[model samples]
Target: MTLAPQPYLNTRVSAMSERLLTSDQIAALCELSLPDLAERFGLEALLDEQLDRRTKSRAVKQALINTLLDELRVLIRPMNATEAGLVLAWGRKYALFNLKTLLRGQLYELDQSEISANLYELPAHVRLPQQELFRAEGVLELLRKLEQGPYSLIARQGREVFEQKREPFALEAALDQRYYGEMVRRLLQVSNQDGNELKQLLGAVLDRVGLLWLLRFRFSYGLSPSETYYQLVPSVRLLHRDRLLRLVNLETFDEILAALPEPLTSRLAGSTSLMEVQRRLGGHVTDEARRTLANGQSGVARALAYLILREHGVLALFSIVQGQLLGLPRELIEIAVEVSEPNCPADSLADAA
Candidate 1:
């Protein structure tokens, strides 16, 4: 796993960490107007993006991701093939977002321009062939084209779920499940020796998303236990398969909260709302990633940790910038940045708005 010399990655990441905005710093920036914030923190790129009325939000979001991924390409240069593949799997989530958009567009028979509006201009290596895929006349055809490309497995799984359940929600869930399933495979490949390496770093993540998704799919969407269970990512220590299966049957938040195992139970005590639970869990994962980044381990774990924190930072930055540019209220601005859940593949900008 010692892919290459560690000094370069360590030094680069450590230096970049200093340059990243602290939570307090970001909070302080929220108090300033767009101009003042841009001048202060050198957010000229965001400022420039805001000037475009038509593509303001989309442009800024794409800018943040592109910058992050470009830096990732540099950081992962020293990694061995397997290590790089793991990082790429994580980074490719954005490109997959485009695939999600395509699927939804085809589902509704939306115009190509409208679909393209929501897609990100991902790094060339990760970018999907949108023009070709856009030619499909229906969701099934779109998926068929998708299967010929990098996301063949994800598309195939999505098709299976769609064919079985015949619902858009389940189709998107299947795609996410397959994506994470593939990610887990690559994660183990890099760190399966002792099963001790990324378990802690990624365990918090898997657990956090798994729990939150279980609550939402089982309750919010009212899917059956078996159906909701299929939508979740692979289980982790605290919320293993058995606990999640039982969790799916609970009738209320109180029952689910009471049934949770130790640590999670104590940590989430008195947390009645799913939002509160999500905020707490998200912060926990963020803290763990920070610790992993600072840990003196091999570059693989630290690099992964860097990407997690870096993604969080850029998103917070985007939330602040997007809110300020749009003249949204302070409360709205603050809430936008708080880590809750990842964007659902089925939701477009319109769906989010």
Candidate 2:
């Protein structure tokens, strides 16, 4: 798809970037205690109104997510169809989550209202037929109904996995695989500098996801090499097909790590836990995105960078809130959120504030 003139797009992107939450804002949010957070945001009474703490917590979280989606809608509204579609594709992760929720709700025969409450209020153009999906009598019925929408292919594959193994993990993995594959395909069709940069960013993300999934399925889930490989998002630069096959066949996590190419191997060195691996890989992506935002020649890259940073801000907030809900120590919560930042050092949170 042809992008509108770059100069105009770049100016718009710059304005949008300026409007994103500043690092200081994120740090301040991270440092707030539960009471402080509720008081500052005027969320305390609304939270207290909920009968259950879990429900209250979900309400708060959904409020934040809705705010983010609103910002996203504003960003996309002025763009041409192709440009908007490209940007909106990043938000499709939420749609995928909603679809998964529908499948699970159907599987368990959950109440329609209950499922609807859990679903994010996506933009109209990007929304699924949630009412119909919620009303589906069972998993098969859900997939059949989904065939009428944009998610038909994924729904079909998910149904196959469900029917074959009848396992939630396998079905979820199938859905993830389909989503990332389609994401890459869509990004590649753009055929411009911005598209190429965005694809590179996504490629790094997909690689991290593929590696993490491989490790989890192989060790944590005890899935066979073949089963684990089947669930991967077809392979990317960091974990190409040959490398993935080799890593999957290995007998130990260390062996798998040893087989990886340089930089990733060095970057992930000495990581003993999956969480550590995730943080390291996430940091790599964040760093790359920052560089792209700073040096990229295309408006798409700058806009995409803002979106990435915005997402990180949301995640850090969620982590802090979850920690507070669990009654974790403030210091630990700070550490968790600080480590999640992209190119920033652990001490950078303090500096930002």
Best by TM-score: 1
Assess candidate 1 and give its lDDT. Answer: 0.75
Residues 277-319, model 2: lDDT tens digits: 7777887777777777677776666666767777787767777
Q: Model 2 misses residue 170 by how many Å?
A: 2.0
Question: Which prediction has the highest lDDT against the true structure?
Answer: 1
Give the per-residue Cα lDDT of candidate 1 at 151: 79
TM-score of 2: 0.86
- Candidate 2, superposed: residue stretches over 4 Å from native: 1-5, 19-28, 34-52, 78-80, 339-353
lDDT (C-alpha, whole model) for all candidates: 0.75, 0.73
In candidate 1, position 221 carries an lDDT of 68
Pairs that collide, model 1: none
Listed per candidate, the RMSD to the true structure in angstroms reads 4.5, 5.3
